[model samples]
Structures are given as C-alpha cells and as structure tokens.
Target: MVELRETRIQTRQRVQPDDTNNYGSAHGGMVMLWMDEAAAMSAIRFTGEWCVTAHVDGIDFRAPVPSGDTLYLDAYVYDAGRTSCKVRLRAYHEDPKTGSRTETTDSTFVFVAVDDNREPMPVTTLECSSEESEQLRAEAFAAFEE
Candidate 1:
C-alpha cells in the first residue's frame, strides 16, 4: 500500500550550461523535464506499478533560473482515480549559498498506472494518517483551486 506521504517527492538539480538557453537561464523545456521526473517518481511511489504521464496542465513559469543556481523540484499526489493519479509539481530556483528560493514554475500532471503489457491498471486507495501529510495534501489541493 502507498500512503499519501510516500507520494510526496522532493528533488534538486544543478543548472548547467547545457540546461540553459542563450540568455544563460535554464530553458523552459529543461525545467519541465525536471518537473516531469519528479511527478513520475511520486506517481510510481503511490501506485507501486509502472506508470506513464498521460496528461499535464497548468504549467506557469514565473521566473528564470540562471546557470549555477540549484533547481528544486517538489511533487505530491493529491488525488487519484481508479487508474490515474493527479500530481502537483512546483519548481524553485535557489541561491546555493544563501538557500533562498524563488518560485519558477507550477503545474499539474496525471500519470496512469500500467500493467506488464502497458495497459492501465488499478491503483491502491491513498491515505494520510500523519498531520504533515494531511496538511500538505490540503494545501496542494487549495493551490489549484485558486
């Protein structure tokens, strides 16, 4: 069984020259890729099954991340259907020394669990017993409602 807390994933990546655009800022595509990976991990953790990204929405890029900054990605599964999990993904650009972060992007991704033959599979019901997970779940849901 996968609890709601286990579906919450946090990860980071260093912005290298290869990941940046002509302006020396991280390309939108690269940032989207990082968000996708983070959401994929959360979905796989929640379903314990092979999963693929079926849809994405609400991609809003608020800031640019210059090369040498750290890209912080956080994702969590806030809702699910019989076979699909909805994930909230957020990205931030961080100052390596100061640890201050600036919001860069926000989006939602839906991943569908798959069987051995790549057919959609049922997902276990998600639950959250701890206060932290519950709060995170609530805030994630509220963010999209805005």
Candidate 2:
C-alpha cells in the first residue's frame, strides 16, 4: 500500500536564457511541460505503473519566473480512480542569490496508468496516515468534483 505522502514529488530546474521568452520570463509552455512531468512521476509512484498525461486544468500563472530564477515544481496524487490518478501541482521560483521562493503557478492534472501496450490499467488506492491528511484528501476530492 502506497501512502499519499509517498507520492509527493518535487523537482527544480534552473531557468536558463533559452527557457525564457523575449520578455525574460519563463515560457508558459515550459512551465506546463515541467509540471506535467512532475505530476506523472507522482502518479507513477502511486500506481507503480507507467502513467500518461490525460488532462490538465486550472493552470493559474500567478507570477512570472525570471530567466535567472530556479523553477521549482511540486506534485502529489490527491485522489485516484480505478485507472486514473488526480494530481495537484504547484510551481515556485527561487532567487538563487537570495534563496527566497515565491509561488508562480498551480494546477491539477489527471494521469492514467498504462501497461506496456499503452492501454489503461488499474491502480491502487492512496492511503492517508493522519487525520489531517484524511481531511485534506476529502477536500481535494471535493474540489475535483466541482
């Protein structure tokens, strides 16, 4: 049994000059790409199977990540169905010199577990350890229903 906390994932990448747009901010597409990858990893950790990006929504770009910042992505499986996992993702950018981080984006993604043939496969449920986690899990599920 995989605990919900076990599915949590965090990744960081330097925002290089090439990763930015003409405005010197990280490209929206680049951020989304990194979020997708991080979310898939969380889903895979939960299901122990290959996962593919199925859907993404509510991608709010709250702030812009400058070219010299370090982009940080955090993801976790908040809920799951028979074959799909719902992941919550958030992005932050840190000033390398100042070591201060600020949230830049947040979104939700659905990933479907897949077999070797890329066919949808069944997944196990996420287990929550503490009452706080259980409450959070319920809230996350409710948000997804809306």
Instruction: Output the lDDT of residue 30, model 1.
Output: 93
TM-score of 2: 0.91
Work out the TM-score per prediction: 0.95, 0.91
What C-alpha lDDT does candidate 1 achieve relative to the native structure? 0.91
RMSD of each: 1.1, 1.8
lDDT of 2 by residue, 96-129 (tens): 8887889887678999999999999999978899
What lDDT score goes with residue 40 in model 2? 90
Instruction: Estimate every model's Cα lDDT from 0 to 1.
Output: 0.91, 0.88
Q: Please give, for residues 33-145, the per-residue lDDT of candidate 1 as tens digits.
A: 98999999999999999899999987888999999999999998988899999998989999988999999888889999999999999999888788987897888788875
Looking at model 2, the pairs that clash are none
* lDDT at position 2, candidate 1: 65
Q: Which residue runs does candidate 2 get wrong by more than 4 Å?
A: 135-145
Worst 10 residues of 1 by lDDT: 137-146
Number of backbone clashes in candidate 1: 0
Displacement of residue 35 (Cα, Å) in model 2 is 0.5
